[model samples]
Target chain A: MSVQPQTQARTRRTWLRVFLIIPFIVLLYPPFYNSNDPTFIGMPFLYWFPLLWILLTAILTGALYFLGA
Target chain B: MFTFNPVAFTVFIIFFLIVTGMGFIAARWRRGDLDQINEWGLAGRRFGTTVTWFLLGGDLYTAYTFIAVPAAMFGLGVLNGWFAVPYTILVYPIIFILMPKFWSVCKQRGYVTAADFVKDRFGSRTLAFAIALTGIIATLPYIALQMFGIQVSLAALGIPLSVSIGGLQIELPLLIAFLILAAYTYTSGLRAPAMIAMVKDIMIFIVLIALLIVLPAKLGGFGAIFAAVAKKHAASPTTFFEFLSPKQNWAFVSLALGSALALFLYPHSLTGVLSSNSKNVVKRNTALLPIYSLMLGLLALTGYMAIAAGIKPPKSLGANYAMPLLINAQFPPWFAGFAFAAISIGALVPAAVMSIAAANLFTRNIYKEYISPNASERAESTVAKWASFVLKFGAVLFIIYIPTAQVINFQLLGGIWILQTLPAVFLGLYTNWFNRWALLIGWFVAEVLGTILFSAAGLKSVYAISIFGVSFPAMYTAFSMIILNLILAIVLTPIFNVIGLGRGRDITVATDYDAEEVLPVEAGREALG
Candidate 1:
């Protein structure tokens, strides 16, 4: 096994996995987008913000899976 | 309260018949020998990505989402309701990391249940037995909840909740619906739900999108609908809010996190995952399944739409009827039939999967292990088929004999109870470093403490509590007990080691966990041949 290159690829995938958890953590922090400002097509940011992140996280996961991580 | 709307009833009967036909025919969808437990119980472990997506999305997001999410919001706003958005969003990422490994190892070991994995990994039948009993016990109420969902929809469709015959007042509609679900599930096994889910999900998405478009227009715009919600919340700020109140932040976070963790631990969810053919299918689903979460978000808003349309649930049914009542109020009679059928079909899919999953646990861990260790695969499959019916009837008995309030409470306890197995099942996926005895002790402590805390809190289904002179904010009893459970598992590991209690040999190697190759069903069958 090529130790150095394998470690580099493993770390890259680990970072990608960490990216997956970001949206989960972000949506849980209520203070960030808990207000009714920044509405999207009449939905309060409170609702639309997390809804948007659901897709964003999905995109990130799709990327990670295809990347063979 | 019951008006005979001929159009709605006819349309409902039409869609209901269509799905029922789909269920019976699904037995031949992928003609496998149903004699083997693996073939019958887990769809022969042969589902590809798209099928797995529909099956899991249909299985995990139940009538609970269709009725309860909107109803909760209509009744109590953000804390009670909208937490599901975060819960669903958080669920995938967690599963993305955890479930593929679970699929991989379970496939390699031919493990049908988490208890199977626990018994093999930890070398303890007692621990495996603990996990199986908990899965079945937690699942009975969950299956009953889905029955209750169908009952609510039936009640909305103008069927009486009960009919008296020969001094016997029976819940005729629910019993009839449960029988249909039981018959198909017993015959078709997991394939029944996987096939019917394709139709149920389509109807649900259609009903959801049609309502999202039509209800907003009828009730003015989303802005107007929310403004009415705002007005109501403005009047009673304590009960309803667009955002979480400061006091509710912990409750919201813990409820969302605890539920996200517990979602996959449910045997029904595992049945959906293990039915898939590959790690890649499970991984692909992590990306695709959020379509339901988006639908859940849109559907939850219908509660506010119900309010804006000035629809009121009957005082008898309470707030859980909010969405069903809103459906009847807002939609034309024919379309209302389709919507009601969507909700009721939604109930059948998960109810079938739940009973099969529980029955899989019962047959594999209980009967095959204890009753007849030398039982043939065909006999095991037979037991699973019969047990699925009996387990489902147990759920039916729950609905008939138990109050709906208590059933919902039991469902909440189900969430708490399943999370107790996290250390043994989820954590053990990575390492068997923790002693099995200590892990069982952790599970026992959490189960007893969680139940005691829950009961001590009275009829309130979920709550937070103080531990050792420190008061945590009001949150789910499950989340709090899980913290204590984790602490005990961690602390007791070293002590148990010092006392020379063996953790048993790790039967699973790293390569078992690292099996990422997808084996399609033909190759799997040839291997069997």
Candidate 2:
């Protein structure tokens, strides 16, 4: 019975690691975020999206750490 | 000849002296036997998360970065400069994955330099020597650029960098500052820079905060600043870019990806990681270090602020002067002096760390391996201290005598040369199935061919390749060479193994890569010394 929970915990940890790839997928492909229509304040989507991701990435990394990833 | 500003000079000197004092006092901070190489060079691997975060930030985001990145944005535009944003953002994820494993292995087996780890893992002294030589050579031009950072700061403050003494022109202020840096590094070793980095980061944060708040309000807003950039881009469409042009997309993505891969591979960056006490410390820092990346991205926008404010630097100084000139024009003299001092101190921290890192590689891989086979820990540390001093002095002389353009050209090549080691260092972390000789040949081929490609592109780092009468869009030369390097290593590894030429031994166990920290050996030895 205990072995089943151990495997479940291990599998959950592995899935958490996959979330780390979100920033790379979103930021690395410039064509996806390279638009001007979605301007936050006055900054372009190209500029503000990457800047916003810096915070979101940090929060994600921190979450991964706290969740025992 | 130089327009002197007394208030600025005085403020700069005061901050400089404070850090100089801190440099000396840092030797006593976390008491250890300064005679041991690990103790002197890696701060006995004792730093917690906060110190490691500051040290790596100060080491990686250098003084040249402050002058050059904004200068690129102010002079050119997004594709030329702002790729650094994505580049820095991408670095943390890579670090989060790789550095904790690296830290664990190094801590378990007592590896001081990346070359030291490569030497043991591959069991080829020749391969290790190649890595050590590449690291030392690549770092020299980088150190020279740090001195260039100080020169720009002083020049901006209206302080003369050189003075005619007797018949020879001497860069007096720079020489004096370097001497102080060398003295502290020699006496305190890595501890000096580690401690000073904290102060440098705080000062830089203050400068960044002040600039972000003041510059935007004065020059309308982010919208106006970027609109001004668009207007200028329209005026000279070919020279400036408000965003990556269709043709520039490949180059932009390649540079960001390539540079993020290369940043931690540099020996100085590894030194910062190795100095931390635990794998968790290194891991936590990846989450924290993006604060500086955020600051750097905002700082890049000051280039657009320069445009909106209509601050024109002297034509001779070019766009490198744009940030300094903007600071001079907009801020009070006292604040300007404070900012220049922050930049100059910023240069000293990285310059000290790079020299120590290069020195550590020489002492561990070259001098100990070749010259003195059984040198004591005290002897190794002693040699490293002197080597760090000599390396910094040589860099100062090189910058003073060599033309700045020549130094800049070599620094451009330094990035390409250093990235070729990625196959051996980064990939070797995961698998040692690669034959050592194959890795060496791959490195050699990449170095020679990359240099040729860089030159063919007229000394530019980005190049368009034509193969079989088909042309591809320009990409970072380093990225293309690294791909070639990996292919060569992969193909030749099997051929070499088939011939029974693979004699490499792995001294490190698999568990070493995940081993949690033990109390450092130096802790017990501290009282004996």
Candidate 3:
């Protein structure tokens, strides 16, 4: 439960760097992937895109909290 | 084409007046040190989880979502409607990480606005001023969009454009509404709107859920509606059921990303964070708020249902009345009046909070930092009150002067401009690598390019594009600007750092990011009080 200030600082930096890369990945991907159908969970990939973001956000926040970043 | 029923209009006005009266009485509720900007602008930063939830919900889900999303779906089909779901989902997590840190820093330093944090953290008033100006300018169009929402609802209700009083013709609906909003926001500060938000949000939930259930059943069911929409898209072969072309796809993705980044950067969202009683509240809400997105998805579908029901929007007024028209046609007069009230009340709450948030930025960053530097808390609060009033008035003017359709387009344009502020905001939360000058340069580049591209695309009318000899509507321009912004920000960060442009000492020491078990006295009070 206790973290040194320096360790905590380094962890925070790592997490920030990780999160900053996500938008780029999500943004750069094409609408439809050749290997996958355009549907995700019975809706078109386009329709599910925002829902994807919702999940992405939750995972990222959980990571940051667990990692103590 | 759109006419307001006199009986419905009278009822609407009476209800609004009652709410306004209640809002005014709320001024004395949960009294705090009204002299302080935090007290006035942020409700003394004392809102617990329940209050914070309603405040943020009310603030974020404006008339824009309640009316505009369904309207966009009705007019433009799936593309624009998609924005609603993504925006709500994206904003929560983005704020989750950024907001807690911001809250800590602001609490540590007694910062009331995002501009305050920027000023103190960077020790540069110029950078702070730029951020403040951007928040206010960007928020103006957004507030105007809310007014547009109210106007559309009123038009749908058949309210006449002007009312004559003893041979004196007056065009005063928008003006009257704005004045009422300005009064209570000034009187009760954040709390006035925060309390009102509870009722507003509950009404929205009830209305939306009732419509979602009843509308589908009334319009030959969901299966029938989807079939109609699919048939319509197939017939057109140009607008619906088609992904953006490659060029447009880039724009779509970029706009979404840029907006996601810029969203929490808005002063009002930050005010919500600062007002929360604890970091846990922020975290919990990140998970909880997505429930609204679920509701939004249902709301978006109502547009397709409107189309399926064969309810044509009034030609003179713009398609924003699609929801109201559909509801009016399907329901009886009293229930339709209730729906109109839901949308109107929805617009009022966020507009009030946004004006208050922007005014707080002006007071804390512009007035106190630059104007007096030694201004008292009372002086800061007074300035914020007047600034909020002026902001609401300016929004009314924006609605009156600009064509409704053009104003809606400008709101999209404003999204592009606001998205440019991401690096200075979201990135600044946990890193010091980005120099202030680089952020400024990135923001300027994004704005200029976004404006040019959006305009060059001719406001992206009707999603027209040719893929292998087939065409579709254009929805790619705004997204393109976002890409250019990111590249510029990323590319310029190291360059500016290498050249030492706007590179100051790192004010965020490592210890600042840590979540403490034993909170400091002020932070503890801020979280628990």
Candidate 4:
């Protein structure tokens, strides 16, 4: 099941590269989004921002995977 | 409130029996020769994307996450609790990068455990032994926590705890539950959990979606839930809703980052990763497993719902009972039974995986390394199978004898110890410049200092310390210890090399870890690296 070298190089170019960076940005700086105001569906910003990123991160990961990275 | 409801118990038993039947049938499902260590321990390295997803999801998100994440919120708000959301989130990216390398390398070598890979990579048996011992010891308390999860469900169901038998009091239900787990795990090995996880995860998803949708409407919505929680915090100023205080900022960040780093270092997490058929299966699963993380976040919100609904645990079971009690209070009896069944079976899937992973460590790293170098593959399989039985039964006994709070504290302490391996196993994957003995010394220093700090803080599960009498507000001990560990390894490596000490030979090359897929079964079987 070894990938052809040409195919492997193309996989290396895929957006899967960004999979790790998005998390480091969202999770490392909690103070930026840590508040109970500006509520979404009656949930706090502090709570919902992290929850929202859960979906966004998943989408990012899936996009990268499909892009062949 | 605590009366025995036969309806809940009957539904619980019904689901329990179905899981048991699944367990027995799993041995022959995708049938393999059980005599080899590969078939017995790694599920023949044949889990594709779907099976790997369910297995990893089912294994990583266990009963403890179901019961305790919410309980952490119900009892103490942000610092102790909400870190779980980010902890779960950060784990995937970390696993995405690190675990595929692990899978490729382990596959190339026929290495069954992380310790087996470590043993070959650095050409150091002692270092591999350290890693294996750490894996076993670190996992035991976690397995014990799963048993505690079962105990919580039974307590809610009002199962008789101490039924006198043969002139001795025993936790009869807990004993019976573990015996069933041990039997199937012994007979079927990793396959039992792989099969049962599919059922456990679906049941949990159904329960969570139903409960989350209905509970918020029943309690008048998320705003009211948080309002009730805020009211409770205002009533008791010192305990709840510490997010505004900013005192716990370090604690929150460190707890999340530290645990995310520690998650995949665990033997069982590696067990799940190594069981997959290829690197792509693992990489794809990393993308999809976050669905479970989303479920975990919603489930953690249910803790506040327990508060808003005015559900209180009986004094004996304490706050951990918050989730189970809330289920019984809000749901009808049969649904509560299915919920409890979900929790009970959730505990089993991971428990089976942990024991199998730990047993493989024993068989490969310890038993084969020293006990009998030429031990047949059959002997290795036999050793791992019995070791799984004894190891899990021991975990069951550990929880029964110890207090649940202490078991939790002990598990936190286990996290501190396991993170010490970062320099040895995790870093060694990228580079082996550090002397093996330096890594060992770093691990020892971190273990001792982490323990002393944990003990110094009045045995608090999480603590921050005063260095040179400058007190820091609370931070996680594991994160602190890992920093000290990394520094020690960095500092001591060149110092050891300057003296007469020597670095071990690196037998593995970089390309070995870039293998595209696992070799054919016969080819992989023939090479005994």
Candidate 5:
């Protein structure tokens, strides 16, 4: 979890940063997940989709954190 | 005074006292000098992963989020309420990308405020002053709203917010609460809130978990709750939509994006970030802090739960009372008291941190930079402490004197105003290519035009503009204005350069943005001083 001090050259994994944009693209467009036809445990798609994304996005961010992007 | 439960009142008072006691004791928790601005304002930047997580969760989620998100769902349904879920989800990835660099640059320069980094990066005192002024003004109504959150909780508890003594009206209860808050904040600075944030967050989480489990069971289940929400929306098609209509789609997207972008730009959020010990701490917390967002999403559903419970808030308290009333209806008096204390204590943590953040801006960018160029570190810290007191007191008076609707309107505009700083603060992190004067011009134009647009939209944050008889769908005012702000800065930079306007010197080196800790070069500046 500690940043490496001896790594002089800055980690410019700018390509890895693209993974960060996935949640924004997925979650921002309500049209993509706005339907209620799909229900999870009685919650409609509209409701459950974003709630599920919260966990997914957290994992996405956690992955990014681990990759040191 | 509609339903005074003495048990709830006593329980609320007891928990309030516990946090107040903890607030005072926090000064010694990680003990730093009380007379240095960095030490006092940022807890000497020693917060590790877990502490920073709680501090930020408590800071960003806020009492406003606790009350208003559910309140919006209860009152206005999806567009108004559910957008917050996506907004919170989107913010962390943003923090994951942006804040580590911001923390790195600030640490390397000993920058106490974002405006401090802007001033150095752009080398424009006027631009820096613009940023400092905006941060302070934008946060003022926000702090007032935290007081409003406490007022709503007390009202729900049937406690008198004000009292008459000798024919003089006094907000005695709120005054007493704020005085206790002010005392500890003055004595302990950011440490008070950092310590208390741990308590506030745990209590909030417990309340959230209890409500999520207990309420759904009482009201059938999530299926039944959504059925109730859908039924209500069907009953009032004009007011509430169970899903985003085609036209409302862009507005929701923009609102979510705009607010997510604006959340961390607020000085208080950055105060939480800057207080952390390292970029890794900030990065780690971004991943962890979404736990609050998950809580917020469930909390927003409580508004739907209120609908399911058939709860109606009194006309005086309005929708904000829905969550508290739902609690009172479903939980016992003692639990209601604990929930109310969780909320009011929730309000106190952000209020303290925001005032400290705003005070830091004024001291570093305005007072020390302009009013007294030769201010000693002790003198600077002293000014910040007093400034924090004055700002909090001012907000208390603002809540007591002003209409809550007016405060809400200003807070809406505050969001728009703060995002205008992004060109200088957020974009300034990666590159210093933009001319200083160009960035200032961009900020000025965006702020003025944004306010005008907000007014044009009847002070709503969403507006649909028709240009040349071709109408565009409504979008978030902050989102639209930020685009304009960015375009203006980008177009003007080369123009300003070619016209022979000089750019300010950047004091930071490229590696500063990737540095793991405060650079020795910054320490050298302090030594020279």
Candidate 6:
């Protein structure tokens, strides 16, 4: 059950870095990609803004499980 | 302010009084050595899954979300209002990773606040003090925002309006509300607030579900509602449908992401985590709390309904009153009263929890540490109780003095300030590589820079820039500050390490996260010592 301090610390760092970067990529790209026309399930990129959080949650949870576990 | 129905007002008062009575009794819910800080402030760290779920929901979904989210959507259109949905979704996973470790460490060391853990891990009172100070300071405006939520709800209920004489209003009813809340919170601590949260959550569900069902019928139908919204957007294209535009998309994403990171870092959220009895409780709550987020999405739809129903907010009132106005305009008088009570109760539970969290920080970090290092457990608990009272009173003052229109800005301003604490909190949770002094320095830089940018943008109510000739609000300001904070910490940590300013100390050997299922000997010793 005991995790080596070094390994745990490294895992924590990796998770932190991923958290910092993922939001940037997800938020920054979609606006640019769909600047001309945005559509997801007949919803505009604007309408999809809130729903994007679903993907963000999955990514964050997956990363946390990977690193923390 | 509308006229309050006599029968409805009577019922609401009776319900509120009953809850207040229960809160006082809650002081004894989880009986323990009443002398200790943990026993008083964290309910002896013994809440199981069901209680913890209700507790966290009550703590997180405040009157702000209840009134403000729908109000924002109703007033500004869908783009601005979507922030709540994402922010709630993001908070779950972040906490899932962080809370289990936090719980383990806190339980093992008998720590009452995050500052206690920082102090133990770093072996530096200064660092711990900084953490405590940041937590208390950042949480104050938040507490004030809750009071603001109450004031908005009360104003909508016609309580404050009826008291107005010539332009001089007597806010006696609102004052009375704060006094009642302060009394119960001082008596019962965490138990008082946790117990009340159950009532608050139930009321919220009832009111929201009723509004969702009833409002569409009032608005003619979903198609009519959307059509009205479309017309509104068509008239003002810049503010409404164009999501990728600066005011909408970037600000929405940035605010969502920034808030998600900062949400659990708040001392109140940490209080929720440390109060849990087991790690499984935290994990289970994490997966299930999304149900609240789903409710939040449904709640956001009320704004669209308001627009369709043609419910225009009064000139003096803020957008936060839109939902209340819509309810009064559309629902039966008794139902409107019930919905108003839901919002009022929503403000009460979170405000109570917030003050308790702030008070705990003051007692554990300030009073017990520098003020009297050898302070007894009883003395610490006493300080926490008094601090909670004073903090709630201060929030009452904030509600009284600040104009309602400015209250929303103050909430956002509070967010900007609190987000400054992320590097110190989220980073320090796992590593000692961040020098205490470096963390402090980073906090200072971020606070200064973020404030300047936010203010200089002229409270433009939006910060946008031209990217390839498209205008977008500069939503990334918080993210920018966090980045700057991290960079400052990273840069200064090594320099301080080289200079031996804040050398790493021995962290507790027992990994508290793993201690969740099993009762570690260290946890027992720490708790009973």
Native-to-model Cα distance after best TM-score fit, residue B212 in candidate 4, in Å: 1.2
| TM-scores of the candidates in the order shown | 0.96, 0.96, 0.86, 0.95, 0.95, 0.87
Candidate 1 per-residue lDDT over residues B378-425, each given as its tens digit:
899999999999999999998888877576778888999999989989
| Tens-place lDDT digits, model 4, residues B1-529 | 5668999999999999999999998999778988888999998988878888889998999776898889888988876778988998888877877888889899888889988888777778998999999999999999999899898888889898779989999999998999999999988988999999999999999999999889999999888988898898998889888364667677888899999999999898999999888887787887899999999999998888999999878777778989988998899999999999999999999999999999999999999999999999999999999999989988988998898877777878878888888887788778878888788888888888898988888676478677899997788899988988898888998998899677878899988787865345434333211
- Writing each residue's lDDT as its tens digit, candidate 3 over B1-529 gives 6555666667677667767876887677678887788788888777766778788888877777877788878776655666556556666656765777887777776778777766656556777788888889989989999998888777778776558889986657767777888889988888877878887788788888889788877777766776677677778767664344445554354445556666787777888888876676776677667666677777887888888888776577556777788888887777777778878888888898899899998888888877888988788899999999999889888988888888777777777766666666666776766667766777787778667766776764222335598654454444555556668877887898787676655565555654543534344344333
Give the candidate number with the greatest lDDT.
Answer: 5
Model 1, position B416: C-alpha lDDT score: 93
Whole-model Cα lDDT per candidate? 0.88, 0.87, 0.72, 0.86, 0.89, 0.74
Cα displacement (Å) at residue A24, model 6? 9.2
Which residue pairs does candidate 2 place in steric collision?
none
Q: Could you tell me the TM-score of chain A in candidate 5?
A: 0.77
Per-model fnat list: 0.72, 0.58, 0.27, 0.57, 0.88, 0.17
**What are the iRMS values of all candidates?**
1.0, 1.0, 4.4, 1.2, 0.9, 4.6
In candidate 1, stretches whose alpha carbon ends up further than 4 angstroms from where it belongs are A1-11, B518-529
lDDT comparing candidate 3 with the true structure: 0.72
- CAPRI verdict on model 3? acceptable
Candidate number achieving the greatest DockQ relative to the actual structure: 5
> Alpha-carbon error at B310 in model 1, in Å?
1.2
Sort all candidates by DockQ, best to worst: 5, 1, 2, 4, 3, 6
True contacts kept of 6: 0.17
First chain TM-score for all predictions: 0.75, 0.80, 0.51, 0.74, 0.77, 0.44
In terms of docking quality, how is candidate 4 classified?
medium
Q: Who is ahead in lDDT, 3 or 6?
A: 6
Task: Judging by lDDT, tell me the better candidate of 5 and 6.
Answer: 5
Winner on lDDT (3 vs 5): 5
